[model samples]
Target: MPSHEGEDEAWLPPEIAVTVDLVILTLRASVFQVLLIERGEPPFQGSWALPGGFLRDAEEDIYDAALRELYEETGLEAGNLHMEQLAAYGTPGRDPRRRIVSVAYLTIAPELPEPVAGTDAASAFWTPVEQVLDHQVSLAFDHHDIVSDAVERARDKLERTPLATAFVGKSFTITDLQRVYEAVWGVSLDPRNFYRKVQGATGFIVPAGSERRTTAGRPARLYRAGTARTLHPPLTRPTPSAAPEEAR
Candidate 1:
């Protein structure tokens, strides 16, 4: 047999660690907020980051790890949240401590109570998303980018999906739904136009056979989220016009 030693050599795989990061978003007091945890361990200890952690072992599922981390950091249990995979990030030097490949998860939760930190988190709390995107709050690792991506994802979902209903209670008025759009999209919508648009989106919402009294106006009809998870006549997001080119 001719020189088979080299061909028979065993192959070695790179040592890469897997982790899950959650971008839990919710609206509070008409402001968009994201959940962030202060790291309690080294490498980024004392720094704010998206709540997450390394995989427990080789056998644990990626999504299960995400759910576990969410619970650990927020005290919010499984089934109570509807998390969707946002994206995966594996850029070199993303994590300083090791070679980390993170799978990001996203969720739009209703108004939640203050979170109690667990696992390796020093403290967990909700902060305005604008603060992180605007650099008001410092983030560790590659979390700032993750937060930005999640925010855009949420904004997009509001246009294509009936995700805004997730931010409210069992029943809500048209104004309640409109406020969610205004807060997340960061724009004011004309009430008459908004009403017409939502009404056109068949199955987006349905009458709940109830009304809520307002301080200044007539009782607003309360509607419950419909069975449809998507909008037929989708809500469209506004796009800014391009700036005119300056004269040469």
Candidate 2:
């Protein structure tokens, strides 16, 4: 691996540029959504693209650059965000202007205040992943693949990591937690088992001394995400085949 200064100077080919992209996900309408901005310039103009920008000389760190790009493209401040370096994409001929390598990051937010596009973007909005994936996306550069990778990472995180807790409010209910699971997993879980499993998980959630009665039927206790960032003994996912092979 090249040093930071070397990567910026000698390693970067003139035809290849470096940029940072962010995949910001949040829960809206009880479904998971990703933020996309409409590109205004050429090279996939008028197409939806991830919020990103080229690195500047003043930017010292790649992670810091990504956070800055996130705020620049979408006027939302990086609040208690669960952000991590997702991956780097460098496929030859990915960008028309030049060969571009993009460092991607995944951001999970509770509830976004609002998004205002600036610079290379025309407008920004929170879009359902299904709606965006359903269409043929010829995005700017290799963004389509980058976004796909980010989405898959988020899905896998939801499986074993306590990432879904980021979607819930400071204080939440079993139903609220259930909704996060449902939205991320895209599967309906048995309410009884879901409740039992969640309750059994040590430090997965803690009570905040609050209660709310959902219109559904019963009054539910409210809780908050525990200090634990991860589930020690990760929750086991239900496998499709639980029975032994049939006897011949």
Candidate 3:
């Protein structure tokens, strides 16, 4: 056997931290919004960022940690909301303290209640997506890039997935669902064409039994989310060149 070289030397593993951040998307009063938290600690103290934190322990599952952080900071449970991994952000120097890689998630929910800050968050609230994407509000760390990716992910998903249904209440009208697309896509949709496309998507929306909308318009039949999670033909959008900056 060959003589052993530096095998006796002690090896110290790099101290890399893992965290999860949530981009909770919802429609509040016809506007598309995302959940945000104000940090209370140093390294961008008092800055607004997505609600999230480091994994509680090595044994903790990433998804479970995300749910825990969501509840801890916002007091809102995931509970049937659509959540999926968005991406991983591992840019050196992104965090002032140490090397950190963050796993971002996009959570789609409908009309979530007001957030009450807790844990390490100084305050929590629903902020319109445009405010952040349009550079109105500054964020901590690399959260702006994270938010941009999450929003584009949402818009892309809206074209193929019925996740848009997750942005409305349990019961809503065709018009109600249309607004979700309009707000998220940042484009106006023709109501008639939207209704036709929705109707053609099998199992996309089932009529609510004996449920009638009681709003300003003429009596309209209510609908409950259906079994399908996608549109077969899928809704279409304008090309990036033809669309407004918001749409792109």
- On lDDT, the leading prediction is 1
Per model, state how many residue pairs clash. 0, 0, 0
| Best-fitting candidate, scored by TM-score | 1
For model 2, what is the error of residue 149's alpha carbon versus the real structure, in angstroms, after optimal superposition?
Answer: 1.4
* Candidate 2 residue lDDT tens string, 59-175: 457887887887786655666777889998888877777777889998888777668897888888888776656654445666777777877787777656777788878888888
Ten contiguous residues minimizing lDDT sum, candidate 2: 239-248
TM-score, ranked from best to worst? 1, 3, 2
Per residue, candidate 3 scores C-alpha lDDT tens digits across 75-181 of: 66778688889998999999988999999988888888898886788889999999999989999999999999999999998788788888887888898998998
List candidate 3 stretches off by more than 4 Å: 1-13, 215-217, 240-248
The model with the greater TM-score, 2 or 3, is: 3
lDDT of 2: 0.77
In the range 1-248, model 1's lDDT, one tens digit per residue, is 44544577865668999999999998888889999888899988899998898899999999999888887777777666557999999999998877899999997778888988877888999999999999999899989999999999999999999899988888999989999998898777778878999999989999999999989878999999888888988998765431111100
Off by over 4 Å in 2: 1-16, 136-138, 237-248
* Residue 234, candidate 2: C-alpha displacement in angstroms: 2.4
TM-score of candidate 2 against the unseen true structure: 0.84
